[model samples]
Target: QCTVQLGGSDQWGNITAGTDLVRRVAGGKAFGVVSPLLTNASGTKFGKTEVGNVWLDPELTSPFAFYQFWMNTDDRDVIGFLKCFSLLSQHEIGELEEATRVEPEKRIAQKVLADEVTDRVHGETGLAAARKATQALFGGDISGLNASEISEVFGDVPSSELEKSRLGGDGLQLVELLAESGVASSKGDARRAIEGGGIYLNGERIQDVSQALSIEDAIEGRYLLLRKGKRAYHLVAVCE
Candidate 1:
């Protein structure tokens, strides 16, 4: 029998039922505490929508994605979020808020919030994995990630499947692939972009317009990551 039940204001009915039952059944005193629902700078209550909900289950939302979600919090909302979701002291949060005000580009507050909240929900090992994935993706050096890690990193990006045989013999031309996979507007655009040194295969810049994707280019011989410019991405899955 808990001495107190704490939940969001929306859970008042549910929590009071438990507290009342404890008093009635065991003649014991129990307390129910309901706090207001946390929200961002916008009035949208957190965790109420499906478009950007972060789930506790790693399958629904990988630890890395969860960490990145917090990392990307808006500057206007980071401090309030830290106060509600993190265990940092008021002094530390004050420092972060000051940092945010003075050097918002550094994203100090968002980083701290992401780190503490991710570590709390996912623990140290999961936090480590999240950090590794974050580094691999943002650093543009994903060669260290295995197939599953690659999938997790680009799971939301547009993708298409290719026959495993496409990589046989001479392998597939990079320009043809860019068109087939819809990474570029057309093969000509893909070629011109390659010439401009903008296309990246598995994270490394590909300057050669003649480059071809071989089995060696595939991570674990299962997937290939193609990047256009800084943020747009597409995944090519090799299948039988």
Candidate 2:
């Protein structure tokens, strides 16, 4: 009894075929609404990132990653995504567009897009977990997160294991640790990264390249998080 069928742009021919059949056999007039293919401003198809396609399945993509996906939407694409993916009203979207123009650094539009899409896909409990994990990841406040949450947030990053003894008592030297952990290519590279203020240990910027890391720095007494820049993360797990 529907008068119109909706489909993606690529499915237009098939939709028209169905409508033709419906008119001939069912003796009814039907219309179609073909949504534009979702793409970035560069016209590259959406949903693909360096990691892979952004999946709705939480098992395929953790709630934290899912939320981060939307949060990372490019400034050029946020407005279109808000229109396409968010349930916000036109008035709300217009307001966000204005906010984006006024305060691009605040990222109000991206946050709304992330919140709406993640809430729709993962529900309130999942959204809460994602937001909390995000805050901990970005704010150097892992005290609120546990072992499982830590693992979840660090899921897509490179990870390696190290001997607990190497971190014994006084702990391992930062540059050597970074090189061995593969966060940097070599001792020289690690030192350069640290001196450039591009190194982070468990989300905290490592201003003192001379500092060492011990078991006390591990989250839940087993893991160390390393970041070379804003987005590149590496996990170091301590083993007995």
Candidate 3:
């Protein structure tokens, strides 16, 4: 008889216990393979985005988000992740490493990592859907998507809905809008943030406090992505 067990790093002690039990009771030696503990560059345990755990199931973590997560992996971790997840041979992996070292902007390792894992968990169809969603998101093209797809892509983004009437002829001031959306705590703070080069609108840096949201700038006629610094992000939805 054989058994398979899957667990995190902390479960090592328990795993050994189970192996010992199997050997003593069944009169057969047991073997095991332990996966490396995933961690961030800071050595903290790896987890999902600030939201929760990274799940292999598409229902739990959408394919697009999963692809983006892998795509954004640090240069330092891409090789290790590729080795752990891809079906590539050792020589192929070595070649990938060489390519990465020689030309990181090519991001060959990261692309392979994203493609293999995405295909495995979400299948080819899902991978294609994810790639399309990613392109629409970063490429500033949103005309082809339906509402549901739009929701799926921006689900985790911090968003605030606004009434269409409120966005009348005079568009809201940038500083006031930032504060109202909780992107910044106060107008003074918002001004400072913009001046400090910490604010972005739709992926482009917005250094002017006088700027206002235009109907043409909305993604899918509803959403706007606002970024603060390198990592903090917010989404704004305009509702009719």
Candidate 4:
């Protein structure tokens, strides 16, 4: 007397087969809803990053990282997502549109998009944790986070381990250091990166190629965050 059907766009043929089977065997109309395939701005499949497919589990992505991903969406995608994922009132959405049109840099729409999706996938606590981590990382406020939280926030970045004894010795030159830590390939490459202003340590651009890592610069006594350009991040950890 009743039937349920579930399928993605790719499975439409199979769904029709099921409908045919049902009509012949039980003589009832079959209904179906097909989900469209999702993609990114470049039209690549969604849920994938440079690292790989993004996992839905909180343990895998952390709520903060997930939230940031949504918050960084291109302007073109925001309205479409509002329709697909949000329950916001039409009035609220209209206001968001006005805000976006007036000052896109404020990114009100992107924040709402991120907040809604993060809450749905990871809950409020997860969203909060993610927001906190993002602020600490991007806002240059790393003082309050415990070691575990720091690790969780920077977990996906490229990392290299160094011996604790190495921390006390003469520090490495910027070029040799970056190369030795696997951030760059050679001294020449490191110099090029620095000259181009592509290298940053703890969020500040490093202009001097001769600069070296020192104990005072380390975070929580053992880690350094190195950024290249706008988005490439690498972590250097000193181990005992």
Candidate 2 has which clashing residue pairs, if any?
Answer: none
The order by descending TM-score is: 1, 2, 4, 3
C-alpha displacement of 210 in model 3, angstroms? 15
- TM-scores of the candidates are 0.85, 0.69, 0.62, 0.68
The segments of candidate 2 whose C-alpha lies over 4 angstroms from its true place after superposition are 1-6, 18-33, 46-52, 155-158, 165-179, 182-217, 227-233
**Winning candidate number (lDDT):** 1
Worst 10 residues of 4 by lDDT: 45-54
Using lDDT as the measure, name the better of candidate 2 and candidate 3.
2
Ranking by lDDT: 1, 2, 3, 4
Predicted structure 4, TM vs. truth = 0.68
RMSD of each: 2.8, 4.7, 6.1, 5.3
lDDT per residue (tens digit) for residues 69-164 in model 1: 999999999999999899889999999999999999999999899999999999999999898898887788786789999998888889999999
Write candidate 4's Cα lDDT for 1-240 as tens digits: 557588678779998898889999888888777898776667766644545445688778767767877788888777767877789888888888888889999999999988898888888888888788888777755566666777777787888887666657777566776888767788888888999999888667899988877676777777777777777778788788
Where in model 3 is the C-alpha error above 4 Å? 1-10, 19-53, 155-158, 164-234
Write down the TM-score for model 1: 0.85
lDDT, residue 231, model 3: 60
| Each candidate structure's count of clashing pairs | 0, 0, 0, 1
Candidate closer to the true structure by TM-score (higher is better), 2 or 4: 2
